[model samples]
Target chain A: MTGGRLAVRKTYKLFIGGAFPRSESGRTLELEGYNVARASRKDAREAVVAARKAFGGWSAATAYNRGQVLYRLAETMETRAGAFAAACTGRREVARAIDRVVWYAGWADKLAQVLGSANPVAGPYFNFTIPEPTGVVAIIAPTEPALDGLVARLAPAVVGGNAVIILASDDHPLAAIELAEAVATSDVPGGVVNVLTGLRSELAPVLAAHMDVNAIDVTGADGDVAALEVLAAENVKRVVRAREDRSPWEIASFMELKTVWHPIGR
Target chain B: MTDLQKRGDRSPVPTDWTYAPAPESTDIVRLQERYGLYVGGEWLETKDQFTTIAPRDESPLAEVGQASEADVQNAVAAAREAFKSWSKLPATERAKYLFRIARILAERSREFAVLESLNGGKPIKESRDVDLPLAAAHFFYYAGWADKLEYAYPNRSPKPLGVAGQIIPWNFPLLMLAWKIAPALACGNTVVLKPAETTPLTALLFADVCRQAEVPPGVVNIVTGDGSTGAHLVRSEGIGKVAFTGSTEVGKAIQRELAGRDISLTLELGGKAANIVFEDCALDQAVEGIVNGIYFNQGHVCCAGSRLLVQESIHDQLVRKLKRRMSTLRVGDPLDKNTDVGAINSKAQLDRITELVQAGTDEGAELYQPPCRLPEKGWWFAPTVFTNVAQSHRIAQEEIFGPVLSVLTFRTPDEAVEKANNTMYGLSAGIWTEKGSRILWMADRLRAGVVWGNTFNRFDPASPFGGYKESGFGREGGRHGLEAYLRFE
Candidate 1:
């Protein structure tokens, strides 16, 4: 038993409302003789519909419930480690991706504490500021270290109870689709995570400027930073600039300040 | 003449004269009817049309489809139809489309920049360095928002406001398109975009880019024409929201047009931005801001620092330095790599700028110009700065959309804020301060959409940008930017 090696199977499909399916577009992109899945603009829109459907219930969930779901998602991702690792070119990268999930999973319960604090206003009222999750986040996954970078960028957002529309790296998007499958099996709600794999240049602007999306993560772009910043300003979507040297502790990038005021008399 | 000689000695001129390449132009008739108006994933043609001319030399650039009343009706109808289903889509999936669009825009950035310069009469360096990159970045930045609205404005549920009618100015044509269109799309609202009349070619090219990205038709409908088409789109009953970037007069007109109507409006209108220099500020940095403020885009910007408010203590010193700087400002063909100032956007804009410069001289203000030759055929203006300008002067009150700076002096910080806020427009303002607390204090009091501390005219997608008061309402960057496109659920 100690000498034997375990074999794992990999499945790549579009994730919509926590369900895995062949793209509604029924499209597949080819990379290195492997069939990578893709979703059409319509499929992408459908994913958005699915996330919108799940938004109320998922967003309405208690913090405890959201944390539990995120924790369970991390656990499920751990079990699919072999598949994800195989999808990547190296084991070190896959390990980092799995570690990223766990790191962010822990953040589900702790983000409010780390990114938020009680605000001492000039007035005499109970005011405490906490961090909240933006609803649906559109992400451009890193182009180079596909799986690890994608996971690192996405986990903080989803763990915070935000749904995600991620245009996975076109060159090596299979890992992202496979991760979507893992998320489906996990306790994450339906439409909580949607992954689109195709030409990123073709897909990013649609996501960047989609009115329904709340924030954009441009950490995956390999080109001009200024132009991307300007485009993101169109609807004033919160943008997270891509940083190659940042670490997992950079989870604060997905956090937003939320001030809550209540009457002390109550 | 003695004052000019005195001012020349204090500030030295910049010696750099390198310029960038110009864009090639094609016949307008060939481009007009051939392109389809993108609406709801369908390419449709309009019965009405208009021709666009290059402002550089009065040459035809492109003939664009003028959205017929019927075409506008159909596009809005499609947007309304899509809104039912599209708005209902999960925020995450909506985000995917935006991400996809961002990616596509990045791939075709070079082509967009070249086309933008060719159509808009902007320099190739500006189109490449400032406009195209920012245009693509706008998409990338907003793409991430598809699924993140909840966190943007906490407590309240953010929703899509359906179709957005977006009209962009010609100053930074493609960049403005990104500014108006990206967040609208990200928020799940379909759009009918109108590029300026003088610069419709790049926008038409963007339509091609949208098609390549497979952006569903009716999702982005581009109808290119002048103010009439824009007025039609703004007043159209089908549009739920309107976003415009243009002159203050036009913005007020648009505001009146939407009054009493159930429409959300975001106006990024004209600005007479003040670039204030204090005695304590860094001279080199302030000089750079001065040049960048008024010289970038050949001062065709609404937010260009047309008013240079220098501290009375530093007035003589700064003016002397500025005149020396002005002497080296290369004024020539926009296509020449050696030219610092490019061609003016249009004859109308040129006439307006020249008229204002003339008015400054007519008033008590003394005019100063560095030795520079103006292009004969095309619309052009040398970088001119007026001194001894009073706050009450027309040159100080009105926006001169050209490479001209009006110099004035303020005795105190209160005066700086008072003079800065005196204008009807409040798009942007710049303060040169060494003290951190003073920067914060001034930023709090400034009514402008954007306040630049230490630096001027800097922009980021993460940082919210927009104006207050008559300059405009609503924001165009960061999380505040999304509010214009989203509805509260």
Candidate 2:
């Protein structure tokens, strides 16, 4: 009975606020012989709404708490690394992607000390600077090394207390949906890491112009980054054009420096 | 009567106390009849020129050149050429140039201060005490870092980004120029700087100081113009980094213009800051903090505490005290050392402040401006306070970059935090409380970049200053400021 039975195919859909829902437009793009959810501008907007809703609690969470959740995310990805490998390019890439997530996971609590400083400001004042999240960040995930590039960009942003709405790699979006499945099953909260599989040209501009979105990482942005930058300027959004490297500075790029001063008085 | 004023402490005033005239002599600054653009270490003239007036008396100070696209291009090319040598100079040599500039600025501080107050309409006290000293201190602070770049950022080699294009605001003209030029120069980058149209004198004066310091040609170029000139400098092909300090509107425009270009940018934009007063706070000290927070420099500060959030229990007492203190603030000739509030920067700025104040009154809030008379001819706005202001009021929400303060009441710390952050801008916030734990708590919760606890409007060269949201990005002071001018290898 088992030998003749047909295997059911997976219906890839958009991950919005942690839920695997089909795109509101009910559109799909054929890629690698699979139907992937083709997200609309409205879908990108909804993702931002969800991300904004999650921001207050997530950003307020202690760095230690954020670190723990990110660590759990790595563990969840490791368990499903085989599936991730099958969806993306290869096993080496999936392994690197999962390892990169763990690397960023460790930086969640340590970024403040490395990136922030206490100032000996020449006054009777105690001054210190700390890095705070830049709120909802929109990540344009890269195409090649799909899983690794997305994790490299996504982990740093999320680790620093920012909620993300990622426009997954347009060509290799299956890996993104698969990663979203792992995110849903992990300790990461809903709306924390939203995945939209669609045309970068269609979706990137909407996210760039969204007023609620505080920062953008265009590491994966393809063609006319200037146009996207122009849209990002409407809100004075922090535009990060970073390389695909795993560093605390990548996390710092999405964090704002907040310096507090108090007079040392009796 | 408004709700809180009914219960406000209405103390009687004595009539006899008044300060004697103490005007700083304007004879110290001998202004030239005409000034040209400082390009490639030379004063070059342009056919297009505009007269810069002293806002204090609307007297034309000097005719300064208006930089055209060609002028801007020439400036950029000069800066680009200079970058080859400047960026290659030994870091120690760079440090020496900066140290010399700092010393010369300190030596000529009074002349620069007089010109700053005369041109920018800031009080002599601020231009003399706050602006000049801080401007000199910024160069001194970044000067030490020039030779010590490796110690600033570990593991990464910090190198200068070439040909920084800097645009500064009318407020604190010399100080903003110092902020822009010091770090760029300390990092071994050549710069083409555009000072604000109304207050280009100090910058052009500082150009003379650059010459005295024997800085190489093309190392620092001063192009004086309005926004169009700034736009040209931002879009120029040779610039590797752009740093601006002004309105959020212009910052966004610059960001859009530089979009897709492989150039770095840092913006010190606008702020609508909140100064929160707790019930248990030291009442007299809090009053002083509130007055200094918004009234300092005529509230032209990017981090001005324009919104005052008071505990509902002490709203009456605090507002009454604040008004009493604000009344004593002399708003008169900027040259008068006794003047606390000074002239508005320009007619356009005065119109903006007037329109916003009118909007506050029309929206049914109570407005209070003390019984001090403004001088007849010049642009002036009195130290203003608005009560019964809702969080949504235009006065409370917008960056009224003048001596205007909008006071809103909050019943709890959470409510105070909620209302404090309910703006598109988050440049700075202030907390007035005796309790140490509460100050830390409020500081943690406030979304602004700079938070002053039990004190307000305090800046130091070592303290990093910038904003969180639309108030713009990157810091201007301290170790973090180095990151903006440096490229990592």
Each prediction's DockQ against the real complex: 0.01, 0.85
Worst 10 residues of 2 chain B by lDDT: B1-10
C-alpha TM-score for every candidate? 0.62, 0.96
Model 1: per-residue lDDT, tens digit, A129-223?
A: 44445557788888777788788787777777677888888788878876787788888877888888877777776776565665678778655
Top-scoring candidate (lDDT): 2
Q: Of the candidates shown, which would achieve the greatest DockQ relative to the real structure? A: 2
lDDT of each: 0.73, 0.91
lDDT of 1 by residue, B1-489 (tens): 122223455874335433344434333223553555677667777776666766667777555677777777777888888788777777787777777777877777666766666667677677767777677778888888878878775656777888899998888888888888889888888888888888877777777777777666677888776688888898788889999998767876676565345578777777898887889988877888899899888998887888999999988888888889888877765544455678898888889988999999999889888988776677888888899899899999998888888998898998888888787666777878676567655654555656666666655555556654456656676665787897654
Predicted model with the maximum TM-score: 2
Residue-level error in angstroms, candidate 2, position A116: 0.6
DockQ for candidate 1: 0.01
